[model samples]
Target: MFDGIKILNADADIQKLMYSSVLDWNSVVNDGTGEVVGRTAEYNNLTLTIKEETSLVKVTGSLHKYANAGIHNADDFTPERLAGVLDSIQKLGIGINSALNNLEFGVNIETPFPPAKLLERLICHQRREFTRHVSKGFEYYQCEHERQFVVKIYDKGRQFGLRSNLLRFEIKVLTMQVLHKKGIGIYTLSDLLNQKLYPKIGNLLIQCFNEILFDEPTIDTTNLSKKDSDLLINGRNHKFWRPFSESNFETKQKYDTARKMRYRQEKRFRQMIDSSPTAERLHKLAAELIATKWEILSNPIVPLLHYTLNVEMGQSIIPTAKECPITGIDISDQKGSSRYLSERTLKSDPELLKSLPVTIGQQRRRKHHHPEEYYVAHNIRNAASNPRNSIKRRIERAVKNTPLFQADEVIRLTDEQKKILQSVPSNVPRNKKPR
Candidate 1:
């Protein structure tokens, strides 16, 4: 999940590594004195900026691309892959304790539809409007200008010309204190080398995603009472709801009033969705996205289909004893009756396996190794509770029927789609001026 990292105060030996590994090395000269101060070079996805006088170097590039041979980052950056990358850094005389200046971590989720639709539905994040930008000539959407971090949601499939609906949702942490605030004890690059920190990182990603307020234009409200329907429809209009979350008041009491009113509005909207039958699909879709992301963060090697089987067939489908997905070593005995370890650790690493708290209660409380499995299974078992179509069941069926990989098509929005996009709050069109 690690991508686009920046490291500062790199060692002088890094210059040697760059000489061997990097391409297009050029001298950065002092414009007035014509004396060379530093050198800049570009590798496939790694950029190196070196100041020879101070031995201070700055490295900024996509660690994901480096791991994938500079191809694309649509695939998972597994624990094993990260270890290998860390080893490469060590070889370059960069300590694992090297402090990162900036960090970006996110997963590429395979959506069922064009990611542009999801991007279009994004209204705002934490009362901040998402700005549209063209990066490297490719269009993407992001919510930025916050001091701590930026929330980015972009079409990975379109960006890399991949044949999948790869929607990349990532948090670019501008300040390391943000991670500390989130209870993620990651100070150095080596801290991330451990498998334990992944869950915390994944939690941060999900929290950022949840903070984004989405406008579901396709929600159905036909069965609702007049008042309920009006609320449902009007709540989705970004223009109508933006004022509630924004604090324009001069006095503290007035600000508190707006805060209380905003909370009430949000509660009402959430209550409506929870109580209404039409929102079942939206809830399931959200659950699926989060569950799938957690599953990948927990165990990237296992295929998504394996979870599908666990949901559909339960333990009867998986063998009584399961081997490590990476090394194929037996670990079923490690977790007692549970077929697999919750955080799939390599059998070769006994310390990692032993690190797991094996108490029955802790075991039960452990994050599911297959989060999507339990999620889908739970929803499938309770399918009859929902009057509308079972969103989980539909998703399962679709996944089962669809090919593992398929080409993502360019999105050509219909007139109706365009209208919905235009209605989204704060998303001013290129040709229009902000009111």
Candidate 2:
């Protein structure tokens, strides 16, 4: 019975009238027509149709039942109620606009599209056709993935609540899927909200969509090499490609031989020091020889000349007053003692003293002490000479140097103080001089 109902392209005036009206099922139905049939409203697609009735207004075809209901409802419907309902819808539109303004992907139009308008028109047309349609409720439609999804509002009381929840859910799910496919992980509903509101994220989303979906194909990774792969891995142990060359082999062989020689020399030195009875003495002598050699190589001329000059000058070369004076026993004895230093005789000699060069540490310590003492004494002398009295001296010098009286200074004084200063007698009274 609900077939061949052709919905014509409604005129602007009719469309406006339908949206402005607030007709419902119970309000449109007339009980006098031998068991009135209740009209069902599809909430999802927002479509409504009424059953044909044999009455004063006969509706035989698809348009018959709707026409009958519309006539009946319009006869009793008040203009004030219709206006109030229209106002409510207008307010809802305003709210939706405000909400879209804050969205990352803002609404494309100032008003709802043709599809939305079609649904709205059908809703109002059904309401006017059936008496209890508004009281019974309506449906909303969602077209997703090439499939139709319906949301039925059976009870009028839940119309607003259900519609709001479904709308919010639909928006969230759509945005999540879109963002997720673009490599964005929507961990929570809050993430979607943030992306929708945050300006940076919103701009990034637009940029990503423009580049990946609309821009030219530019990324080419087909020709990537092994070196590129190693770089991408960012690993220290990664094997890098080395060019095949004769020089490479020669360089590797040289490095290996030098390393092997260094290892053998170190091992021999370690074994020698570990086995010898005078190992400590030999090691010390080696170290001293190396250090002396390094010094000689660094300044060969200066050190050699200095030593030669010392020998020529006979400094510390003559024998001490206690030793044989004529033979200069100190020099001859030192040479003889150096040869027998490993034996016990030289060690037991009461007159002979070991001669050793001062170490770097000892020289530094000797040089640092006098300079450190001098700095400490200098600071102490400065503190004693000035003391805290320097502050007083500075203040006294400033006071003496500055002009005691000035026009600006007089201006700064209080009126009473200034008057008192001006009234002070310049000369003492004659009577006061007698005292």
Candidate 3:
């Protein structure tokens, strides 16, 4: 339902309101950038999204989503929630214009002005317009009039055509077209947000469109009513408004053939009447004729250009949750169910409960461990591990155990122990004796 239409600019206040409505199962937040994105959990049909940026807050959820949410009332508008959100924003002083979707209407038209003649006067591009529907032999040029409206005109042949669009005497103008015509001087949307600029730009465009279509001398047909002109000009609907009927006629002949037959029959019938003796009585029949063309086309052709203009009107907002209330429930900045640690969720095992703190404390201390405890544990482990030193110690122990050293009550170092200790120097001796 959303047709790529959105409010590009929004105040932070409006964004804050949307943030509350977003569901939090898998919500994401970035404190560094102050960006928050969330979708309404309950309003699943319509994924209401909210974005909080540095300059502006953006809230986007088209009315189509709400209509699909099954909240329709038989007699009321199909998607009533859209109306509610519109009301909520309006209360915030944001113009309704900010949220309206774009509208487009067809504007194919005809005038005394041919595309070539119009091209001479206006800015337009050459086109190979398909004219097969109306008749095989017609050419036209399509171009922009005054660098404004999209205008098309038939050139080579006559016999109303199947133009790109059906003909209307009045031209159509779109909202964006109006803005383009206005160019640089018009007030910006930021001004509209501040309520300083006019919000009814669509209405303004409608006026400009009417002037370009109706008041323009080139398009104005002297006596034709717009409605009559439209019908008369768009007479090329051969298939839908078929020339032949089911009750009569051979195969469905071409539109030109049917037309030629009517003209010929009228001519033969007139010849028959004139061939009678009454032909000599024609000298007696005479009457006055005024400007018949002017008389018939006398009606003013009010150009009825189709316009589906965007309506934008925003109001002041207090910038809080109370500003725009949602139908579901009050939204909290933090989304999710309550984190209540009930008895069922608590640790039930006694040993696990007692050790939980110690486990947590140890894990916590790793980040901020005591320096003394670290080195004390490090010093207890022997790192040097000299192989020859170990052997010398083992030999000394064996010598002390012998009767030579243990002869007395006190175990003293014997000459054999000293010799065993001195046998291997701290520096390993490289010299070897061959036995």
Candidate 4:
């Protein structure tokens, strides 16, 4: 989950990336797979893409230029900064990438109420209003703006939903994990969504719900009345909103000192519990467990970064391809890419990572020729163009074969060898035929 975050700074002119300019190049959109990838990318070497699956847009590439256009000199690598920047993008109205342009928010709430019943209370009491119910817990309301609006409650997992175009602000949550996405990727909406709509909705739902699920109820099970719930929702204290808002790294920094103090207290509490634990009864365990769980649960597991990984470094090379014997169109990989040098040296020596990719990525093809044919062709070309290298090679061969000096019979030498040896510099040693 969210182990590392890499920020992309644009190399190209920022004016060129204002809107859909980056989207113009070799682009392909696959609605079936929910993906759009573009290439020449102008800004970076390769254009980027937006991948949608599980109802969340995963953006790759292009972000560097996009980020560069929006801001000035400030580091934006942490989760909080990442969230705020993404939010700012939609607010600025430069969300050209369709997949990420649609603003969405994801919330994980631990509540006792089922989604269907909770939606019922919210609608019935008019705590908030909705236009109509679509499918299971999926509701639509007349948007403040005339864009596609969605209010969905997930029945599948722990009272959470991942949807698009629900809100009209941005916070791009890109954990930018090359491999996995658990608590990773862009998992945020605008802070406007948080400060206004999200809290009120969550407050209403949590306030109106029961103490436990309907299927498994305790002896003293109870639900909140509308009047009492409303009072609690509008109260000064914010038990629900505080934890939710402070989950990302940026927000957490605001209360850094307080969180550190709480962390210390919790650490001591855990130690105390481990040493003096005599909880045989359910009540005792419950009393001890809830506080610890609440503390741990509120803190986000991963802290994201806006650190930059250069284009050549972040991208993986294409594997070697082999054409089919029959069709020739069907290509399969024969050998995989070898990135041993790039991966190992990147940590200690970043400048070294620049060269190899340019070498491999920008390769050219020429007319094929046989080994002997190329040798002869190259030699012919060399002699016809500039005989300098050819003459040097021939001279070296002649010199090695017949040295300037020779010992045939006694200490006598051939006239040719003698003249050659004499012409040589006095200080320069001449090789002789060994006896």
Candidate 5:
């Protein structure tokens, strides 16, 4: 009947307790005491005995029959039902040994296991009860036995749910130890528990238990509520929610700015597509542009820039670089450079240059003939009379005002006028009347 059960780190106290209970049964069968000892044997300084009467039977052994039964039936023990118990006992033994060893070595026991194991054990018992119906012959059991089993399992599961809630409370107590060992930040627990960090460990835990609980709606609701409670206790509420308070005006402002910037970027892209009859082609071009920008943003360039800025500043304070460190050029060196500022620089720059929109104007003219040359030349002539603002502003104006120019439509200038406009430079000074 005990087949497939496993006992791990079985404590002597638990063994003694089981033995004592069996001995009581033996006493009942034997009319109390050694009056009716049926069989007894000793081997390796340990005793084993079985006593039987008309209506009762009992077995006892000095070798710890309970441990033997458990070990022999290890496979019968489901992890959901027994893992916490086994882990607790093992941790207990380790704790005692650690304390003893420390006393011997003259060092204090630095870390102690919390009540998490007790809570875990409770959870295991709950899971065992929930799965009890699946056990062999459970259907054949008497109504009383069935009711008792169901009640026991339900009660255990409820108790476990309540007790496990304390884990969230223990976060503060465990935080220092976790940070010390893992080198994580003080707020790591909050960060992990926050909904912002969902799809990580928090999601995994929720999914694991949901599967275990048969995906019942009631259990799912309870789990979510419990998780929220845990989050609040672990300071995750503060991590995610506190920034919305009136006192955090600066943070709120920055968040609003970012939201607006994203909205504007999307709106502008939509407008560009709306202005074009070739929607599909424009969409493909937009997708390519966005993908390229995402790839560039994901590169290690930002971190490298931060490092360079730090080195140049010679301090750990804010790292700022106004130029592309690798290319040794100003921030506006590239064709559409104004949009490439680091997030940090955007946050601090008084003019908020990065918040301005990107502008893709017509390409500049090359010396020789090319299909794009006419368009470039037309835009250059259009912009020539206007004073240049920042490179980004100039591009923006050009993009807003210039229509797509056709190559065949270039205006023919008089030969003399063309010669005067394109006059060549000379190394030799021209002779002139004395002035």
Candidate 6:
């Protein structure tokens, strides 16, 4: 459910605990200056880096790997397991309330088709083109990096060398403002312990994928009428349905007719895709992903024994209860936690293991055409006369200076304000300017 995370500006005491007998920290020196500027340490699959100048400690690693013996995150990371991992971190003196600088949530699922083929067909996301990237053996398609978030659809099976056709769809939240906009008020690690919020998070992930525009190869034009063929062909090129305007066209009637034609075409095209066989299968996978997420997130989380996933057998293996090295207490005797998944249930119902999937839909329209000769002048004109309204202007302002966990403080007021404020009278000779 959750993967890579970064904790920034850890407390002094927590920094000491990270460098104590628990893990050894080695000094990092500047090659040119020969001066120690920081210290770093690797604990399991997690890494902690400390800067000498600011005395700030940053921790970066996969929460899934940390919970699963510092190994691959190819299995379902249940909410119950997440709670146990959070408990262990709290015991280690790393405050669970620590603010997260970066957070990623995704699911690994066995796709109906090859992930590579799917990536090839995935052309655009909200009008922004996808940039292909390969890290390790995993291949992924990602949209242009935005300040709020980055969406990734990658081959998880290839990354881990699994024999299954596993695809991972993830959203990397670069800022918490994105979460705030989605009504997810998570600010720190402690907020993640709320099992009730799992459905909201799952829905958010689904929504991100839903906004993607797919160029489905399954669309066949052979049996289609002229009208259907026009929509199918025009919709695929994203630019054929351009916005109509007085400057673009000579007459108002002409632009109006063009706008109406494209509008009708777009509506019909959406309906066509909604009823198509390929679309149905894609939506079905999305439905399954959300259902599984809801089931796991709603489960009671507890400090249960650590478990590992057996990919071959598709089972989660939990060994016999033993004392934890950090806390010096029996794992079964932990207090103040909910008993969500017991040892008996896990062994008997390994079939409960599953993952998530999603679909996409969104479009972008260009406002004007540029003169090829005047590149510099065209860029200046575009920047000054861009089609940004009040809401977009506010968002741009917020993105410039907002903190990761503080964007909530600077949003617009709700609609339930005073009626006077909602409908202010225009200034006149008799109307005095209000201070």
Clash counts per candidate, in order, are: 0, 23, 19, 13, 7, 2
Estimate every model's Cα lDDT from 0 to 1.
0.61, 0.26, 0.30, 0.29, 0.26, 0.59
Candidate 5 residue-wise lDDT, 195-225, digit = tens: 1111122222222222221111111223335
Instruction: Please provide, for model 4 over 96-117, each residue's C-alpha lDDT reduced to its tens digit, 9 standing for 90 to 100.
Output: 2222333323232222233343
Best by TM-score: 1
TM-scores of all models? 0.67, 0.14, 0.22, 0.22, 0.14, 0.61
Per-residue CA lDDT of model 2 for 1-435, tens digit only, reads: 011111212111223323433423332465686565534232212233344342111111121112233222111111122223223323322110111101112111111112222232111110111112343254443222211111111221134332211110011122334545544444321122221122223223223222110100122224535643333232111121111344554688776776565445334433433344432222222222222222212211221111111121243211122221111123334433131122232244533323211221132333454432233323322322221233235345545666675535323322222322333121235345311
Residue 108 of model 6 has an lDDT of: 74
Q: What is the lDDT of residue 229 in candidate 4?
A: 39
Clash pairs, candidate 6, are: 210-361, 212-361
| Per-model root-mean-square deviation over C-alphas | 14.1, 44.9, 42.6, 31.6, 30.9, 22.9
In Å, residue 134's CA in model 3 sits off its true spot by 27
- Assess candidate 5 and give its lDDT: 0.26
Looking at model 1, the pairs that clash are none
Candidate 4 accuracy as lDDT: 0.29
lDDT of 3 at 293: 13
Off by over 4 Å in 6: 12-15, 237-266, 277-280, 297-435
Could you give me the TM-score of model 1 versus the true structure?
0.67
Tens digit of per-residue lDDT, candidate 3, span 292-407: 11111111122112211233433342112210010111223322331111122223334423422231123223455544323222221111112224435645565676746554
Candidates 2 and 6, the one with greater TM-score? 6
Query: Which one wins by TM-score: 3 or 6?
Result: 6
lDDT of 3 at 184: 16
